[model samples]
Target: MLCQLEDDWTLFTLVFAVALLVPRSPLRFCGLVAALYVLWPAFRFRQAPPWNARQVIRPAGDTGSPMVSVIAHRGGGHDAPENTVAAIREASKNGASGVELDVGFTADGVAVLMHDDTVDRTTDGSGELSQMSFFQLAKLDAAAKHRLRDAFAGEKVPTLEEAVEECLKLGLTIYFDVKGHADQAAAVLKELYMKHPALYDTSVVCSFEPRVIYRMRQADPDVVTALTHRPWSLSRFGDGIPRFSSLWRHRWATLMDVLLDWAHHHLLWRLCGTSAILVQKDSISPDYVQYWARKRVALVAWTVNTAVEKQYYQDVLHVNYMTDSLLGDCDAHY
Candidate 1:
């Protein structure tokens, strides 16, 4: 709740600051225009029903397959320190078919498990992951910042190689959420997959950046890949303005999001050789679900935490889904 309030405040301040740049009458007009520009799309989408009438097309040789795989978001985040070995093990124990973990590079180009650019939020240390060497990161306790720190204390950040070894040993599927440093990360993934060819059939490489997914396809066409999507409303600018990021300061993030959306809606998956589409839960509708299913593109929903939402996606939508919690409806057939 506090975070939400802070986001709202930040957004308001940004708008007011911009408005102050204009003359009085034009300022009021500009404010009104901005309000409409932002709110109109959200209002329309909320009132609109899920698109369900479009005819789905499947390219030759493509076939629809029913998939009900249970994926752990951040490797069962609620049950363990996310992106750690403990979380991977717990997800497998909880019956998850696979685990999704984020990958980033340290200062020395060592690939490690991390969702944020900085370790401040998820570790006892305070510093950018990209600025710290792996040796430096190795000393920080990764689990100290988790809610169940006592249970997972002393858990150090695991390297991409270590994570792969653990997942392979446990016979669990690995979903690599490429955060950045795509080229470097792709090299690490390709090397590991080459070492264990069996992973080719069990692992998936997914990311919000199309270039990253495209690069992975270039590295190994046989490797399964997915493109993640979030609707404009749920995007970085959806709830409130983003103040701290360089992307926001330059105002290019929103433009990139628009282009990405166009690509997703236009079936860019075919060109990128992606076998799946990972979408935000609320942004999905019956239409696109059926459409993707017909295209032989597996659909995966993310961060679904509530039982009702889980049942709706699994039972009604009949698509694979990822969840933060390892308990409740999410645990039913994991």
Candidate 2:
């Protein structure tokens, strides 16, 4: 009900702004009609189903420390070249218990570390990662665009196996942020977990795509999994007004997006069998954390950086959190 009110109020403000700009009666009336059309559905909006509030199963062999776990986001991107070997080492050196890295596949089906669909942003290359072979990708400098390029230049993109090896050697937990190519990535992760049983204790596989988390659980039920979610308002529309849709098709799509966002918060855990929920810091509240905690579902917050944010999630909420900064009051907790 509150969500609908917020939406309607936003639409009303937009309509008022349009009224000020248009002196003519016909255009202003059209704008008013469009606003009313969009706002009418708010009164008929149905609430999402309540959370069932069942006990959540903790992943097997996950005997991690009880203290708040400080996960390094993208291998602490603020410290070193993200998703590279140097970043992994730097994160471990800064006392991070675990390092998160994004995983994607090459054209030849080899799993590698990459956040974006294309290599153009992070590497000295231009192409979709899934279209380039491992050999071709290895030649490009992964750290070319980083702020500390001079210190970390010539760093090559590390294969998934190579990244696991480095994390194992450093005794840092591995948090694989599965970006795409789930089937191939799942196969590789299953192989690694089977060969190196320690990963079952030291690693977690997480994704915003529920299908990827589901696939990981199916392939290796013992592999720890976390469902990543950010509300649609933040994820899709940010602070801007929702895009105006004249056609019914686009309006229906928008309604579905709203429903899905509600499901992510209220129902996704039951459907996906995730052991933990990785949510954006702003989307979480003390009550939200307590609800999941009672159900034995761990809550992991992401990309928290400031001292105030760190203190709230750690000291007040007592939930695990990931951060881009490794050295500060945040790392002290680790």
Q: TM-score winner among the candidates?
A: 2
Q: What is the model-wide C-alpha lDDT for candidate 2? A: 0.75
Residue 12 C-alpha lDDT in model 1: 54
What tens-digit string does per-residue lDDT give for candidate 1 at 108-217?
A: 99999999889998899998999999999999998987778999999999998888899989978778999767788778888988999877767888998878887887
In candidate 1, which residue pairs clash? Answer: 51-287, 95-334
Per-residue accuracy of model 2 over 1-334 as CA lDDT, tens digit each:
4533544465557567867687768876787778676655542212111221111122223565356778889898878888999999999999887888999889998888998899998889999998999999999998898878899999999998899999999988888899766787788899988888778777888898877876776787667777787665432444334544456655675677786776665555655556678887877898988866664567889878888988887799877789987776333111
In order, the Cα lDDT scores of the candidates are 0.74, 0.75
Clashes of each: 2, 0
The TM-score of predicted model 2 comes to: 0.75
Task: Identify the candidate with maximal lDDT.
Answer: 2
TM-score of each candidate structure, all chains considered together: 0.74, 0.75
